[model samples]
Target chain A: MTESQFPQCRVVPLRMLKPETSERYLNEVVKVEGIRRMMVNGPSIPAVVPYGPARGSPNPNSNRRTIKVGDATMELRVQVGSITFEVEDAGVIEEIRKVTNAFFTQFPAQVLEGKFMKTEASLVDYCRYGPNADPSVIGLVDPRRKEAPVIIQGRK
Target chain B: MAYTPQYGPGTSIVAENRRKQMNPNYKLEKVRDVTDEDVVLILGHRAPGSAYPTAHPPLAEQQEPDCPIRKIVKPTEGAKAGDRVRYIQFADSMFNAPSQPYQRTYMEMYRFRGIDPGTLSGRQIVECRERDLEQYAKMLIETEVFDPALVSCRGATVHGHSLRLAEDGMMFDMLQRCVLKDGVVKYVKDQIGEPLDREVSVGKPMDDAWVKAHSTIFHSLAGVAFRDDKEYVEYIQRIHALRTKYGFMPKEE
Candidate 1:
């Protein structure tokens, strides 16, 4: 496997964001063109009480609700701590930085440029997708998850 | 000469706060007023007004054991009433939370009686007779030790202690047990992730300045840095050295 050709940048706010805030931020970022793929990461909020005495009980978290980003609607599994994006080039990263700077007026957020995504597919990814796996999709989402990544359509 | 016990060693404000918490003689400042019923509700051990269930018969009715220890030591109210063992656990955020797991254990041990405190990296659990536990829980919540946003009562699934705070300055709870509404933090669910009948408001979260001033945890980014306290570092190094040398029976030169 070769290194990813696209440049990656991550938006790290001082605090984890609520669903509404994350949705607003995602909508703002998605407006910036040249972004190829994006990933939201944070502590997992399961559908059920995953463990303890209340295991299997319904976990009704306000933060885990479905959010509409651009034209795509997707359920948030985690309290979004940070967002990483693979962009077309450095120009796109600068555009993202501007969006982040303008958007996070209430709280400070940093747009860091570096290798934030898995460049090569891991052993688990190889086993899950087999030999002819899409490089863009690999390591994008959890291999165990049955659902595919949601693609936010461009501005109409 | 009389020997005075020092709860901990340090010069930093965080250390002073820690010592203040551990010193039983020092009265903990009442920061907020969380009612007993609210505490009982948050504990989720029993209903707010229900009677405390017992694990054994009342001590007064039971046959007395002919032991000297029993003769001298009086049973606590809960023990005498034969109440069942119950627990209250707390997860404190790393970002200038007033209290942390080990600090909680130390404070509880120094101040409370008949408690079995289990301390972990992120959370602290204290088990005691149900009646006694309610009282302890009340103190733990109402005192300066707890912050509405930075500290949370989480019986299980306590995973947010070390994570970053939410944009609203609240810790991340997977169960979403509590919510910040109208600037007040309210518990919609009990400690163990069970939904409550009604929202129990703790209070508005303390501002950053107040939280930092009262925080017992040493956080480099938010509050006092641990390395800044030279005496604490030296004490820790000495203890570490002693423990390492114990196998070889090392003596001080």
Candidate 2:
């Protein structure tokens, strides 16, 4: 297992602390943020996701609308012996940063140094244009489109 | 073929002849005691080896009984006919008595050697004794008093045994002696090396000093916002403060 296989999130070193404690602290911070899910690199899984009640319905249902947080379908990939994250949701990128920052801030004296690096394409690509597509809803158009513009969101 | 005459149908001829030759004066008697001379003659006639006279010395003359064996013997006192009597030897009462201190002393010796006294086999205990000289010296040092005779014999009584000034002193002596003899200490040592004398004030956080020491690190890190939102900034700060105040640093990396 290469280090790059798991998405390397910027983490502050807390002196002499068990890895489990840091993981737990990070988890708690992410949970409180209403951002229910995120992902860490290995196994290419999503840590969290929001499942709407109208998921199967043509119209959105209010009752089943719930946000699932944390790694769900994140996979760790090794490229050139370096661990890389295959993130399912790009939105979780911000949450990972927040959790990492929060963890370091809790023990600033222990943070020797840290760095943030973004790499690898996301597994999930959101389509911006569809049958009922609103121009405002469309973000990025697919670069490969030759005819009509196909807007898509690439996860981080 | 020529016919030969058969014997008489009635055996009167043979019977009549045997009766004519018979002498009816033969007699038999049971012998109560046979002398050496009689035995020699009997052997000389029956077998060649028997002719070589008996080599055994004459039996010792029996002494006249003070009371007749029949009169003195109580037939019902012992086992019944065909029964066997078995003798079982036990340790001397002085050694085996419940009140005897030897068992306790021996057990203590075993404990020092790291052997459980109750479970020690005889051979193990004997082995322990061979290795126990150093234990004896240690015991003497801790005890502050010595009596070789106390350990030498089972029946020797201890006189005027007094309690030592310090209980620890006594226990230490016992432990030392046991280790010296047995090569192991069985009991747990309870004493902490240093005395805890500082007065712990009520309502004060116990680890306040450690928290204060790491406050700079906590404040700086806690101030950073991973989420652009305002709520997470406050939450991270609170977590930082709480951990700094009360949580112990993890022991391992």
Model 1 lDDT tens row, B87-180: 9999999999999999999999999999999999999999999999999999999999999999999999999988989988999999999999
What's the C-alpha lDDT at position A39 in model 1? Answer: 94
lDDT of 2 by residue, A23-134 (tens): 3453454453232222221111112221222122121111112222244221121000111122334444456555556655544322111222323222332343334433
- Chain B TM-score against the true chain B, candidate 1: 0.97
Runs in model 1 deviating more than 4 A are A1-3, A132-134, B251-253
- The stretch of ten residues in a row with the least summed lDDT in candidate 2 chain B is B87-96
What DockQ score does model 2 reach against the true complex?
0.01
List iRMS for all predictions: 0.6, 32.9
lDDT of 2 by residue, B1-253 (tens): 9964331111232222222212122121111232333222211112213322222321222333467874665432111121122111111111111111333333344334322232211111111221132232233212211111111111111111121111111111111111111322211110111111221111111132322221211122322213443444565688899898667665656
Candidate 2 interface RMSD to the true structure: 32.9
What's model 2's lDDT at A65? 25
The per-prediction tally of clashing pairs is 0, 49
Model 1's TM-score against the true structure = 0.95
